[model samples]
Target chain A: MRVALFITCLADQFFAESGVHAVKLLRSLGVEVEFPARQTCCGQPAYNAGYWNEARSMAEHTLDVFQDAEYVVLPSGSCTTMLRAFYPELFRERSSKFKQAEDLAGRTFELAEFIVKVLGVTKLGDGLRGRKVAYHHGCHALRELGIKQEPLALLANAGAELVDWPASQECCGFGGLFSVKLPEVSLSMADQKISTLPRADYLTSALAGCLLHLSGRMQNHRVGLETTSPYGLSEVRPLASLLWQAVEGAA
Target chain B: MKASPNNYPEEAALVIREHPEVRASVTGATLNFDQNRRKAYSEIDTEAWRVWAEAVKNHLLTHLDGYLRQAEASLVANGVQVHWAEDAEAAQQILARLVRENQVRTVVKAKSMLSEELGVNPLLESLGARVFETDLGEYIIQLENEPPSHIVGPAIHKNLEEIRQVFHRHFGTALNETPEALAAVARKRLRDAFLRAEMGISGANFLAADTGTIALIENEGNIRLSTSTPRIHVALVGIEKLVPRFSDLAVFLSLTARAATGQRLGTFVSLIQGPRKPGEHDGPEQVHVILVDNGRTSVLADPEAWETLRCVRCGACLNACPVYRQTGGHAYGYVYSGPIGAVLAPGLLGLEAAKALPYASSLCGACFEACPVRIPIPKLLLAWRSRAVEQGMTPRFEAAAIRAYAFTMTHPLLYRLAARFIRYLPDQVLDNRVVPVVKAWTEGRAGLKPSPKSFRELWESGEAQ
Candidate 1:
């Protein structure tokens, strides 16, 4: 299957490694991965901020870029959900663009959801062992994409114990630009989320934008937990390359 | 300290930011209200509530004219005068005439957003009649001379310390900063006004068209006193508050309390059809039902915006709104705030004044989910936005930007080039002088970084492979 990668702007700029891991993971599953370089931000920032025209521009760019791909996948659930869900509404009046947006949305999938549900690849050819990981479900992914269990299922397959994070679905207060616009409220919400995190070895989620906000706060607070995307954890080759390598090798 | 409705958004934003403590207090209060409301709704069978509520609302709306006539006839039969006000001015004149005819000097009122809509209190006071707000929350705001920030919790924006200060200044009484202590003082102060006032004015929660009954739901007991103590009781109600049957009350009764305060029922739900019976010991001598259209009929004509009339004024949507949480209800620059308020203010007030209300949401759909009557508030808000733009009510810069956007997005090559160019701009250039209009977006957020390569470039280059 030829899968087009929509490495969201956040992932491209800040979390490049997630992009590499996504490509690696898809290729490892015997899927042909195509990067659509014309793709930029999904226009969600513009759309949510009531800059509908800018968002429509971005949506149009995205739709045109991935026009030929059999399936469009993104590592960030929020961006994919934006593409799959909201873009159609943006172009509801313009018949041609509306149809295009609808078509693009219908074929788009969040990374784990596409892999586990569509591709049916639960266990990769490799695994990481002996790590207790807590999953932070991004609000859009949980509510919009409905990719709740697929990420967990893939984590379990990779041999990581999923630590239950209380209020995991609560927003980390990184509502795109909401953090800057309402910094005090955003910081307060983020602080509350940090308090809910149990002491775990690793924290992970698919959307890197959320991780950037969470990890930035964690760094500022000097909290001692390594944060990584699921793609980062899954793409660790040979199953025993890190601290859990010896455990995997012994097994 | 009159809150003139002019430049209200800027004023509200200033108020919200200037008093960080009030902002924090409203935020905390809203969070608690939201949680309690969620718990209350969850306890009930939501599906059942939705069906029943929708059925009752639809029935009322479809037969609105007939029901209004029936209610009028029934009230007349009960010897209660039913007066129709075509608009706010007419409503005010009718009310003022009634007050003058009786030579009423003092009038006490229960909490009523409808009265606020008509500016009834000030109008009556201007007519030389003293008007007192009897609800504890309303009384605090009336003393401070501000509008109710939250629909149901009128004083939700004021912290206990603020309330204590307001009470100390207005009532000349020393009271501690506790709910019970504060309530006692307000009750004592209002009980006299209720007893002495010859005319009572209250907002109706629901006016049963079939039974000609006006329903008043309150957690505080002032509404009952306001209705019963005065010799003449006048209930001012919006035309949209009418419901066809007494049976429909059960659905509204369930939804209103649960949605507003997360209680199975409010402390008091008073249904008054007319004045005192002959043998009645404590009841008003004359009951007047003033049905005020005041732009509601015009709103009903717009199919896209009419669902706003289904609102029960529960404030559940206000509590659940993200924007309302951060900025509080005041920032919406209207008596109504949150999702329902956004759609409502423009329809009732005019799009020119309330244009900002429509854009004040993330379209999270939480309000729609929270609405007991299942009003699709977010959709209506978006529709209002589109209408505002189409009507040239949006700012010129925003309109131009959207036009540029619509043009560029339809063309792929221009978009790709623009994306590539934007990626290379320095952070300083991107973050230069703040765009005051969109300061909400670029203020604290990570400035947008133009991607090094377009998704198309990467895809065409086979780098993705």
Candidate 2:
């Protein structure tokens, strides 16, 4: 099976390993993953800020960049939501591109959903055996796309011990512009999520913004970011990167 | 504290920074309500009930004019005096006229957010009438002279200690601890008000056109006494509160309390058809139903926003919203706050008046889940945001920044070039917080640092294969 990798702007620019490992994982699964180089941001920031015309301009470019690909996958659920859930609404007035947006939306999938459902490869490796993992359920992925079991299934199959996190469904308050718009409230919300988290070996999420907001705050603006439970995990990375590490570590 | 929708970000920040106590109470109260709602929903098929309720409300909203007409005819047929108010002033004018005609001296009000929205207390007081709030929470806030800090729980921000203090000052009582003691004091005070009050006022939860019935669900018996004890019963209802038939109350009645305060049903579900008939021993002598529009029709005109009218004012959204949990209702600078207010404010008040409200939420989608009617609140927020942008109500600087982003995104080479530069940014710039967004983000969290290599750069070097 072949798929197009839409390396979201955040992952590509800030957390490149997620995209790198996304490709690595897909290739090891015997799936041909193509990185469409001309792709840029998913126009989510603009779309979310209510700048639809600007969003459409970027979305049109993205649509053209991956026009020939069979399926589109992304490491970020938030951007994936922008593509699959909102692009159609953005293009509703442009009858020609509306169908294209809907078409793209149909073939688009988040990394875990793509791996478990589309690729039918649930168990990547047992490298994560005995490793307690606390997965952050990004709001867009869990709600907009209805992705709950797919990522957890993949993590559990990799021999990761999935902990029961109370604030798993809570938002990390990295709501694109909301973080900057209401910084204090955003921090308080992150504090709420962090203070309630269960101790684990790693905290991961499909949406990179959650990681950016959460991992940043966890470290108190420094480097040695540990699990929110104080004496626990010492790493924060995207779900795709963690999955790739699980498989490659075994290899 | 005075706040306005135009300055939401600053107001929210002030609350978060200075008012730790407010944050604690807001968080505690809302979280408790959310827990109750979730537990209540878990016992039944929440999905089916929500879908059914949403469909029913959608029908009511779409055929609102017809339903209003039918309800008016039925209410009139039942010997009810029905009046129409096009705006707040008109509603206040109707009240003013009624008070004059009946020589209304003291008016007792059950908890009505709509009445608060219309600013009726001051209006009645200005017309030489003494107004009393009978609902416990409302009575406390009335004494405090504050707008409701919550949708359902008006005094939710006040701790028991604060309430006791308010009661101690007003009723000259000892600092009360027992709920029953405080309630007894309120009851004694309201009993005298009820005896002397010439008019009773309320807001309806649902109005059934078929039977010309007004349905209200309240845990406190205050609404009961307010509507029944006075000589004149006047209910100021929003035009959106219409149901097709009397039996349809079963669905709303089932979900309203469960969603609001998480009860199987409120203690008292008053279904008043009209004024007391001649044979009726103890009920109001005269009943008046004033259908108030007040920009609801303006909301109805919008194809997408007509769904805002589907709200049942359950306050479930307020309890579930994360932002509301942080800042409480006062920061929204509107009668309604949280997700419904975020959506409803811009529609009711013009966009310019409430420009900042649409952006108050993080679009977490909790409010939509909590809503019994399943109003697509996030979608409405986006719609309002889009309209705001289209009208150029958002900041010009942000608009320019987004345009620049869109430009660079469409032109990938510029994006790649910017990517290369961002990775190599000196620690000083990141630490110094040169950019405003970076400044905002790093206020509490760590500074952002881009990866050394862009994904496209790695892909171009043939590293993936």
Candidate 3:
């Protein structure tokens, strides 16, 4: 199936490699992925800050850019939720725009949900077998999209050891504007979430926004472990790429 | 008391820095309440019950004036004096007038957040009447001369040792009095307050219109004494507390008890219909019911915020909120706190008095999940935020930045150009220094840096498909 990649502005601008990995993973699984060049944002930041006029305009732009796509996938659950859940809300009083939003929202999915549910692929066997992975359940994905088991199911199928962290469902406090507005409380919440990290080798999340806040804070403290989007996890690579020695030996 | 929620940053910082125990206590208490609330509702359809509760409240609110009139007529017919208060000052004035008219030298109070909202105790004391709190937690805080940090457990922030000190200092009890000892001391001390007081003041948990009854739910029997022992009993109730029928109490009573303390029923559920009849010997001689608006009518006028008035004040949302778990109630610097405060304070106190409150939450939504009436607290918070922005309460720079960001997002050419421009900036310039708008964000975390290549550049490179 052909898909349009809704790489969130954060993932596109700061973590483009993850976007590349997402494309590679989708292709390896035999689904074609397209990036809509004109797509700017789903307007989450604006919507979150109560800038409805700006947010609606951004949504209108997004809907226009992705109008032709049969399916749209984004790595960030929050962005996906923003489009899928809030677009209709933004256009509530306007029937024509609301209908358009509803249509586009139906076609949108978070990357992991799209991969597992739409692509119908759970395991990418032996790519990064035996890596101890801890999943950071993004608040929107966990609570809004109800995306609890999909990422873990896919990771386990990919031959990774999944460990659970205490208060895993609690927010990492990177609540868009909330991170900047109430920085002290935001940092305190992040610290509480971070305290559970030592047990896992790498933290995985479906959304890159949480990773950005978490990794940024993790870096501030000089923590040893790194965070990755699920697509970038080594487990999804082909066997040849997974075994570095095999690629080198063949060369 | 501060007249504005603008001090939230400094206040939140202080609460976080000074009160580590507040976090631990609030988290523990809320988690326990959540767990128990779930278990307590195991036998029943909790969601369906919530729907019914919501419908009941909505129906009452829809015909609020009718129900209130019916209630007043019923109350007056039962020989209970009814007073209407348009605002907090008016409510206080009514109570002050009652105290003056009765020549009440001493008063005993049950735990009533409405009274807290009215600032009644201090007002009464200043009016030359001695007021003593009869609720155990309220008594503890009253002795310590501090506002309650938690609604139901007013002294949840205080440990047993702290209570012991307060009791020892005030009642001349032992320094290390146990919980039981502290309770005994409170019981003994308040016994006289209950008997000597010429009047009693209470906040009703629910005002049942069909029965013309005021229901008081308490674990302690203090409410019984406060409303019964004194010759004059006055109940201060928010107009939003009206329920249509006596039978409606079953759902509300269960939801309230479980949502609050996880009990299937509070130890005492006193429903007072009116003043005692001539043959009655043990109850109060006069009953006064003050139906308080105190900004509730304004809250009701905002359709988006009207559901906030549906809250039973069970403190469930506060207990479930992560922000409240961290900052406690005092940080909100108002009568209400947590998700309810975020929603209600803004609507009641206006954007200026509560603009910072709506921003205080991370929008975690645990409170919504925990609300008994299923008030969409997070959604209400967003509504308040929108109102705040409309009123220009946000910082000018922040508003400009958001508008600029929105403009860029809506304009593909500008967004693309900005994206390309940002990519060429050095990591140090982008990630090391805090920018003016996001300075608070980068304070305790690393700043964000743009990727070397945008995703559009990658997709166009045709390396994947």
lDDT ranking, high to low: 2, 3, 1
DockQ ranking from best to worst?
A: 2, 3, 1
Q: What digit string (tens of lDDT, one per residue) describes model 2 on residues A162-201?
A: 9888889988888999888788888888877887777787
Model 2, residue A121: distance off in Å is 2.2
**Number of the predicted model whose DockQ against the real structure is largest:** 2
**TM-score, candidate 1, chain B alone:** 0.94
- lDDT-wise, the better of 1 and 2 is 2
Q: Give one digit per residue, the lDDT tens place, for model 2 in B411-448.
A: 98999888888767787677556788788877777777
Q: Which lDDT tens digits does candidate 1 get at residues A135-159?
A: 7777777766677888877767777
Model no. 3, DockQ: 0.55
Looking at candidate 3 chain B, the ten consecutive residues that score lowest on lDDT are B429-438
- Pairs clashing in candidate 2? A221-B446
Instruction: Give Cα distance to truth, residue B275, candidate 1, Å.
Output: 1.6
Candidate 2: regions farther than 4 A off: A221-234
Which residue pairs in candidate 3 have backbone atoms (N, alpha carbon, C) closer than 3 angstroms, thus clashing?
Answer: A13-B451, A128-A235
For model 3, state the Cα shift of residue B288 in Å.
1.4
Model 1 local distance difference test score:
0.75
- Model 1 chain B is weakest, by summed lDDT over 10 consecutive residues, at B437-446
